[model samples]
Target: MEAVALHISNGVLNGPVSAIYGVIALVALAYCVSRGRRDLDDRLAPMAGLVAAFIFAVQMLNFPVLPGVSGHLLGGAMAALLVGPWVGALCVSVVLIVQALVFADGGVTALGANVANMALLGTAVAYLLIALLLRVLPRTPTGLGITAFVSSVFAVLAASQGFVLQYALGGTTDLEHYSLGAIAGLMAGTHLLIGIGEGLIAAVTVVTVARTRPDLVYALRGLKRPQPATAQGVAA
Candidate 1:
């Protein structure tokens, strides 16, 4: 996903587009931390924090997806699937900040757009789509497997749409000249395939946690049990 480039490849601050999202991410992070959920079990906090850190490190891994386009797992869906949406978004925003401030991975000013595209939109959309798909899916392992498989692209592209909009707004390029539809479609489409990896990781992670660390499932709230079928779909 092009959004992955924001974190993996350098030059986040070199451009204005990235800097905006980076800033937005920081602001949103502060808000989430201040108003974040208090019901988060103590045991899960450390896991979630470590998970966020892992996602940050993963972003550093620049995998060449195409000739010029490189990508990395945003991990928003993973975080969301592990925890809840707001919490997951918070996790991603924190990682983005750490990347920009400590590792110099993303741009400082562009944090806003990055937050919008990668953390907020990506996590929220993925969580929603996964939940929806799960609700309608056969409720069998095969169905859940397929749900997990396709869930990534929804969030990936939703986040990509955030990028397309950001690019259109202050992209410093002619929207028409760039062929927004073709690019967005292609980017989202490619990410659809790439997201399969993310989907598998999410599905397996959920299943593993459900089996081993059911207690660690941050999304399990009030239920006292995290139905192995629904690991973390805002179940809280």
Candidate 2:
């Protein structure tokens, strides 16, 4: 018989670890709520809904990896790039909430850790890394694509590390059998492929939006849109 898939379950974490993650998730989500209320506008409202839905749908189709492991798009980096970090976090959080409560995809007790890792850590890493990269790279579509790709790769890895940290703190698994080093290596290694897929999808989406509707892509907000090849040096 095949081993059951983990699906972001936190069965390994104990009570104290879960509680700590819960508190952190609550505080972070509260902050996001505060920021979103102030920064979110009518322009972003529709996009936010669409992005959240897209992430929810994308997460449903998990592709098989080595043996029992499977991988899926976190969509955190893409969301953060399209929307602001606060709203992006909210988007992923919403997806996680529905998955946990309605579908029972992840553990009810582990919801906090799931949100903290995928929603908070993933989104924050994407925003910070891409922002830093934008400083060195040009303000063109290619630059933004590159920024999104690199940031997304790191974002997934960071989220995996979050899980490893939780496991180290209060994992239910025997240390000898599922050692911290081994767990971290496995999580990070599997997510590396997932991250590459995430980066590619994020880059393509950003490039598409930048080409057609640059206004929708929050990361490219301040930067000037690229002109068509036929309209070189032409005023519109």
Best by lDDT: 2
lDDT tens readout by residue for model 2, 1-236: 54333345757689899999999999999999999876588989889999999988888667765686677888888888888788999999999998888877788789999999999999999889877887777656788789889988999999999988887888877766666788799889999987888888788887777777777877766334464355321111
Candidate 1 lDDT, 1-236, residue by residue in tens: 33433542443223665665566666777766665566456765887797798887766765666686666677887787667677888888888878778766656666677788888989878778767765666444455456555666677767777776776666654545558778788878767655765666667766665556555654443234335655343322
In terms of TM-score, the best-performing candidate is 2
Pairs that collide in candidate 2 are none
TM-score of 1: 0.75
lDDT of each: 0.66, 0.82
Query: Backbone clashes per model, in order?
Result: 19, 0
Q: All candidates' TM-scores? A: 0.75, 0.88
